[model samples]
Target chain A: MRFIFKTAYEQDIRLFKHGGQQFWYGLLGVALLAAPWVLDDYFLGQLTFILIYGIVGLGLMLLSGYTGLISLGHAAFLAVGAYTQAILAAKGWPFPFSLTAAALLAAATGIVVGLPALRVKGIYLAIATMAFGFIVEEVLARWEHVTGGNTGIIVGQLQMFGWTADSEESFYYVALVVAALVTLGVLNLLRSPTGRAFVAIRDSEISARSMGIHLARYKTTSFALSAAITGIAGALYAHKLRIITPEQFTILQSIEYLMMIVVGGIGSVHGAFFGAAFLIVLPQIVAMVKDYLPPAIGQATGLQPTIFGLVLVAVILFEPYGIYGRWLKIRTFFQLFPLYRRGLFRRQKAFMKSERLR
Target chain B: MQVLQVVISGISQGLIYGLIALGFVLIYKATETVNFAQGELMMLGAFLGLTAVTFGMPFWAALPLAFAGMWVIGILLERVVLRPILGQPAFTVVMVTIGVGFVARGVVTMIPGWGTDTHALAAPFKGELVRAGGLVVGMEHIVVIAATIALSTALYLFFRFTRVGVAMQAASQNQLAAYYMGIPVRRLNSLIWGISAGVAALAGVLLAPITFVHVNMGFIGLKAFPAAVIGGFGSLPGALVGGVIIGVVESLSGVYLPEGFKDIAAYILVLVVLVVKPTGIFGETASKKV
Candidate 1:
């Protein structure tokens, strides 16, 4: 194991802890920048989706994973973003302005939802968010003049100033830039006092309050920020799909977002990207493996969900830390080699913690 | 008369929601884990009843059989899937249940005869109607309301008088203390799951008459969340009351309000209730000591 002696306080909050991390991240960044040329258009499209989902995953990770607040209605924010972008685009607004408006609108809605969230915690908060999701869906469906109701509105191509991103490769670059900025922003935020407050609140709300952290302000800020990030992803998603519909943002879609963050690893920024890739790739993998299995199992309409459900269950049961956690374990096993212990990462035995009292 | 008719129908519909919510409360009370798959279990129960009926069994016999079968499945689910994950965060448990729901729905759809098609369960009182004082009521609705009343009464008595039921209450109140008192908390948890499943099965059998059985029927479980919340998370009778309130509001809105209000009336009501009274009507307040 390589250990770095930290002689300065600046080293504690450094974006890159060691030379190895900086080099690997730089290499990874280069690979992403070159991906459009190296990979086929089909793969590039999938990568773009991973970028979009990664953005949303980061948003959710900040809220649920770091802040200890769970939302089952993130898709509603995505809808807000998509619909706003679509509407503004139809009105011939600039791409940057539309995207900003989408984020702001979603943030506003998030605040509305977060207000009620202040009164509840845990499962109650989950249900309230879910109800909010259902209500938003209903509104989107009923507001025919603006949203086009069930028929859905067509989204225009990405237009920036005078130039238009008509090609898939150009769109990919746009998404890459936004994703990088967001990732860097999140990294910086985490090392700051605000992010520390979020982590503290997540670990123990009472203790966080006792330490003078403003609970209501931080919670609402987290919700607004999370929603804004997700909204940006929604704008990209709308352009990619070439259509915006109310049906696209449902409870199931929200669940899928939750699944991405959970499967990726909840607390880590890298986990969001890992989860986005996993979510995109899992379906493709299932489609490929379908023909190899027997007709009864393979051709069944329910096969995809069955596989997805089973995988989710298995992941929760075996590796609660998710794909990122598994990667960490593997890396540790190889690093420690002969001295690796089985109980190195064992979870502490937890008794049933009652929510009733809280 | 029309108002009464709507209210009556709403009560019956709400009763089904209550029945499902009852299952949620029972499981929540015992294990403190919310079962998101409660609706899927109800769907399975309906399918089981349908299968039994197709095989020439009477509806009466099929009902009990499905309940019993679901009871066993519930126990197995608790023992095999949930028991291993004991003491994990509530979020993990909730997600597991959601996964279980997906698997249940997927497996049901993959079944040879079930597939994606909707199937009507053959109730003995399929199309019969009763007219009283210039008001007409479907026999199916009456049967649902009657069955719910009977079940709720039996449950109330069970929790009140029976030793096992009292033991369950004690376990739910304090798991460690109950275990220390030799109440077999773990086993009781399994049985609570079984009872919850059985209750859900009964709800399914009753509900199948109003809405046909289908793979997607489990989606109705989402609506039950509002019901459970309105009644307070831990209160049994609160669930029933909440369900009825949601039902009446939905039914009334379908007729009185403009186009989409009916679809979201329950949610709106729940949101209002959450804003007004977060713990629900019967919810008890407690402070945690750190």
Candidate 2:
């Protein structure tokens, strides 16, 4: 498994632990930059949407995947950001200021939602977040002045310091840059003490508290930070579509965000991006394959969700570590071909039944 | 008189909610896992009943058939998807249920002609009304209340007296201990799930006359959940009381308060209950093992 030798202490903690990882990431960056030129307009739009989803997934991964908190209300935060940005942008607030306001407002709401975490965890916290999401959705739908009621509000074009990202290619580049910055920010945070503290909390609250980590502060901080990033994604999402609606941020959207992390591999930055791409692209894949299926199943718009739900169940049952974990397993098997034991990948019964370490 | 009318209607509405909340309590008590699919199960039951009626079956016969079908679905789900992942993390089990719900809704929505359109479930009562104290009460509401009482009493009797019910109680209290004592813990779990699903089906059948059979009706599970939370998640009787409280508040607020309060009344009640007593009105205090 150890491809590159690391002699210095810093080498072990570096962003890319090996030369191979750096090379792959460098190649990925180039591919992303050249994607607009290579792909058609339709695919470029999909990529932009995937990048935004990736940003939201990263935020959720921090709260749910790394911190062991379950929230069915992330979409509420997205709505807050979208509405905030839309309202501010319509009022002629500067682009950066409106975006900042969106993040701040979302973070404020996140903290309010996180307050329940002080008293509850697990299923109860999930319910609280769901309630929050519903409340936010209702408020958005009813508050006509801000959200334009059921009709929804139109978001203006993205303009920053005399630069307009009116074209699809330009907007795609904007999304890509924001996504890259957010990803790097998350990577940096994960290496910091706060991220480790989050992991510790996820593993065991009792042990984490014993280590003098303040539960209330850190949990809310994770919520705030996660919401802040999601808010940024929401702002970009609004600009990308140039229109926003409360209906767009439903519980289903929130579930999709959770699915991204779960399918990609929870508790990893790579998982967030991988899950985002997989989910965003899944509909296209299904559409392509639909023609080959029986006519009875082919025309159902609902089949995609059914397949999505089944995939979630299958991943949870068969490969709890998700797509990234499966990738690791395959790579390890190839790396140690002909020498690997069958039991090497067999799940321990104790781990299955015992308390989860997230 | 108006207040009394509101309370009566609220009680009937709450009873329907209670029936669904009862399913939540039964499953939670038996398995210690929240069944997010309960509402969808209710929707499936209603649709099944509608299908049976559409096929020329009498309303009375269709209702029982729907209940039985839902019971089978519940048992199958527990035996197949749930049993395989038994003893997994609570979060994983919860997510699986959520997935189950998503699949259930999707499958129902894909049922070709019947799936997309809303239809009326033609019950025997239909739109018969009774006059009482200058208020007209629908007979359907009375039937819902009556059925809820009958089912609750039957459930109470079963748990208190029947051998299987006693065994189930023992298993719920401590599965390992019950197993050691020669009880069929796993079988009891399936039985519990079946009963829960049956109850949900009954709720669906009872509610169909009032709301009409629609795919989106399962969203009522959203309201029912708050009822469960308000009553204390694990308490069966508490769930009923919680439902009543939520229903009465919503009914009154819809008339008295400003617009939109009715929709959020239950959720607000849940939030308040959680803040004041996180364990809920009837839930036992759970202590962590440090």
Candidate 3:
């Protein structure tokens, strides 16, 4: 019902399919820009965190969703970025320089970790990454001079070119601009040949290899790019939080990113934003519900992760495509309401076991 | 003498790791999906064992009671949670098991006093130390090592000689072929889950004397994962050997290396093994059909 009638290659590859999408996106953009002014300081801070997570989620989506490489140690990369920035910033490096340094350091680490991707994949890759995460955490905790050990580093206000995002309201704008730029950058990359190559690898590495896609080059590049993006997000997060610690970026944090991609929609760029917002907001929603429940149940922090687990299971079971997928279904149903068949959306099979790139 | 003492203690700890890794290998061999909840299952087993003992059940009786209870929980978990998504993607299955772990940990934490606090399991062998020609090891360590040997031998014989065990093996190798041959593959899967959970319970009971009973004991399950990987995810003997290797390495490193090296030694070993031999020590070469 919402078919796009494209007449040219340019039109077919345009970021927006039609004027309607552009309008909606523009309206959303305005709302984000206006958010700090409308919302209180507490909510504004939450928005900053969500944007940071969105950046992290985007990096993961590019690797896991697009490249079909699963990693459970993303938090380790984040730690690398954060520590790099924190250490450099403490030594009086400017904001942009430290941020770039962070991304470079994190990317280098990602490449080393991605070396295992050449030999193993799927669960083995996941285990390797997780092991890497633990190693980074151990190093962070023990290397007291550089990482400040368990005590952590306090990042001062971000300053660049005589401008400072000292206030929550001001910092919101900086995060907003960076997130928008990254999201747009990712969208453009997806339309590029490299993005198509990633999808090809994900769908079937054997087929992709036959089609002349260099597995090592593209795979490592994906890892490096993803790590760089996540590192930038980490650098932003460190500045926003003003204090950073190894404990903050644990394996659990990595899993939370995976949950975001799964719950948002696995293979879509929009899914990254949706997942980040959902996960960031879900805990707040849970905290609000505490008032109605009994004291013990209400106050229990463990309840949050319990609900996250249940949501993840429910999402995978019912809507494997996630909230975005469900939305598409509902929108399609409405568009073709009278002509919709009883089993219009029915498939021959529900779940396909993804083939690993061994 | 110090080295000998460490080796003795390491073997004991390693056996416990092997016990938990056995549970991991069991489920992976049968289902082909790593159950991230294996640790929480071990923790649950420990809690149930503690509860039974607190209710005046003797240590011996409490052990089996806990095993049986865990067996039921395992069966119910497979039936209710896992069965619905049996043929789904392996990633989805893995995630669901992680969810199961989260739920298990959350539910355990909500159980008031039992969930929040750490308590000694008060085993029959508690606090008894054994000395043999200048080597001193706790009686708990001796029991753990002995129990591991007995369990491994029993499992080996069961698989080699028992009809149902063979049936399970047949099912694991190729579920559809076994199914066509009139094997009840689904029921076997449930039994496998039950057995895995029971093994996890055994591990918890054995480990409780050394580490004490606490919700956080489930974290050891994460450590066991490295053991399973080092041993080969699917091989039982590999899991045992891997566990001892990890345990000994950890104990020795804790004494000889820098402060934090011991904590990460298992993971480092896993990374090295993955790089050097992706299939692990006893893992069969998995061929992918194009």
Candidate 4:
């Protein structure tokens, strides 16, 4: 194993821990930037979607993974962001301003949801967010005057300062830049004292309270930030899909977001991106494998959900740390070689911790 | 008379919600984990009942078969899938249940006869109506209410008087202590899951008459969240009462309020309840020791 001796405090919070990380990340960045040229338009479009979902995964990871707040209604925030972007775009607003407004409105709604977070917790919190999601979906459907109801509102192309991003490659670049910035922003935030507070709260709220961390403020802040990030992704989603519908943002969509973060690895930034890529690639794999299976099973409408569900169960049972966690294990095993023990990653069994009491 | 009619209908619909919520509370009370798949279990139960009926079984015979089948599936689910991950975080367990739900729904759809189509449960009570005191009530509604009452009474007695039920309660209260006391906690948990699943199946069969059996019918289980919350999460009677309240409010809203309010009435009520009394009507309040 490669070990680096940290001589300075600055080294502790460095974004790239060592030269190896920096070099690998740089290589990855170059590959992503050059992907549009090497890959066809269809693959580029898929990459753009992965980037967008990665942004959402980042937001969800911040709230659920780092902060320990579960939200089953994040798709509502996405809907808010998408609807705002579409409405503003229709009004001939500039892209930057409209995007900012979308984020702000989503953040505002997050605060509203967060108000209840202060009172409830665990499953209750999850249910509350779910309820909020359902209500938002209903509102979107009923408010046809603005949202166009079930017919869906058409979203225009990305128009930034009179430069319309009509081509797939241009849109891909836009998504790439935004995703990089958001990822960087998240990385920096996590290393900060604010991020530490979030981790603290997640680890133990009572302990965090005793340590002088303001619980209400940080919780709301996490919700707002998470919502804002998801909102941005939603804006990009609207532009990509070219149509905004109420059905697009439902409890199913929220669960899919949860699935993305969980399958990626719950507590790691790398996991978020990995999970997004997995989600995007899984459908393609399914489609490819469909013809190989029996026609009855292959042609069934429920095939996708069944596969997705089974995958989720298998992942949780065998590898709770997700794909990123599995990657870490494989890397560690290879690095340690003969020295690696069998029980290196075994989870300690404990009795169920009751969430009934505050 | 019209108000009474609405109220009566509301009670019947609410009973279904209560029944599903009861499943939620039972599993929750025992394992301290919410089964996101409870609704899907209900859906599966309905499908099983429909299958039994199609196979030349009587409606009464079909109901018990579905209940028994779900009970076995629930026990297997607990022992095979859930038991291994017992000590993990609640969120992880919840995700697993969600995965189970997806598999259940998907598998149901893949079944040749049950493929993404709405089905009617062909109950003997299907189109009959009873008019009493200037108010007309569907025979189906009466059957739902009667069946719910009978089930609730049976459950109440089971918990109150049975040895196994008492042991299950002890286990739920404190697993370690119950183990020390020589109670079979793990086995009890599996049994509790079976019982919960059986209850959900009963709800599904009863509900099939009113809504018809469809894959999406499980979505009504979402409304049961509000019911569970209103009645408090831990209390059995609370779940039914909460469901009734939600159902009545929804029924009233559908007629009195604008078109959309009915869809969200339960959720809005849940938010209000969370704000006003987070513990719910009969919810016990406790604080963790340092």
Note the DockQ of each predicted structure.
0.60, 0.41, 0.48, 0.65
lDDT score at residue B60, model 2, on the 0-100 scale: 94
lDDT (C-alpha) at residue B287 in model 1? 39
Please say which candidate is ahead in TM-score: 2 or 3: 3
Candidate 3, superposed: residue stretches over 4 Å from native = A339-358, B160-163, B166-178, B287-290
Judged by DockQ cut-offs, the docking class of candidate 3 is acceptable
Candidate 4 iRMSD in angstroms: 1.9
Q: What is the TM-score of each candidate against the true structure?
A: 0.98, 0.94, 0.95, 0.98
Question: lDDT tens digits, residues A1-358, model 2?
Answer: 4567668988856898877888999999999999988999999999999999999999999999999999998999998888888888778887788888999999999999899888888878888888888888889888887689888888988887778788889999988988999999998898899998999999989899999999999999999999999999999988877888888998889988998899899888989988998898898899999899886677766678888988888888788878998887888888888677767877655222111111
- Residues A234-320 of candidate 4: C-alpha lDDT, one tens digit per residue: 999999999989999999999999999999999999989999998999999999999998877888888899999998999899998
Question: Model 4: number of clashes?
Answer: 0
| lDDT by residue for model 3 (A1-358), tens | 6778778989978999899899999999999988977999999999898899999999999999899898889998888888888778777788789889999999999999989888888778888999999999999999998889999999888877678878999888988988998899899999999999999988888899899999888999999989988998998988988999989989888888999999998899878888999988998899889789886766665788788888988887777778788777887778898776746655335323323212
Candidate 2, residues B25-124, lDDT tens digits: the string is 8887666678988999999899989889989999999989999999999999899888777655567777888888888877876786557578899999
* Two-chain complex of model 3, DockQ on C-alpha atoms against the true structure: 0.48
User: Candidate 4 residues B1-290, lDDT tens each?
Assistant: 78888888888789878888988988877677889999999999999999999999999999999999999999999998898887667898889999999999888877889988999899987889998888888898888778777776777677778998888766666667788899888898899899988988888988899989988888888999999999998778888899999999999999899999999999999998987898899897464635
lDDT of 1: 0.89
lDDT digits (tens) for residues A1-358 of candidate 1: 8889999999999999999999999999999999988999999999999999999999999999999888999999999999999999888898999999999999999999998777787888889999999999999999999999999999999997988989999999999998999899888889999999999989988899899999899999999999999999999999999987888999999988888888888799989999999899998998999899887778888888887778778878888888999999999998898889999988777667565764
Model 2, position B200: C-alpha lDDT score: 89
Interface RMSD value for candidate 3, one decimal?
3.5
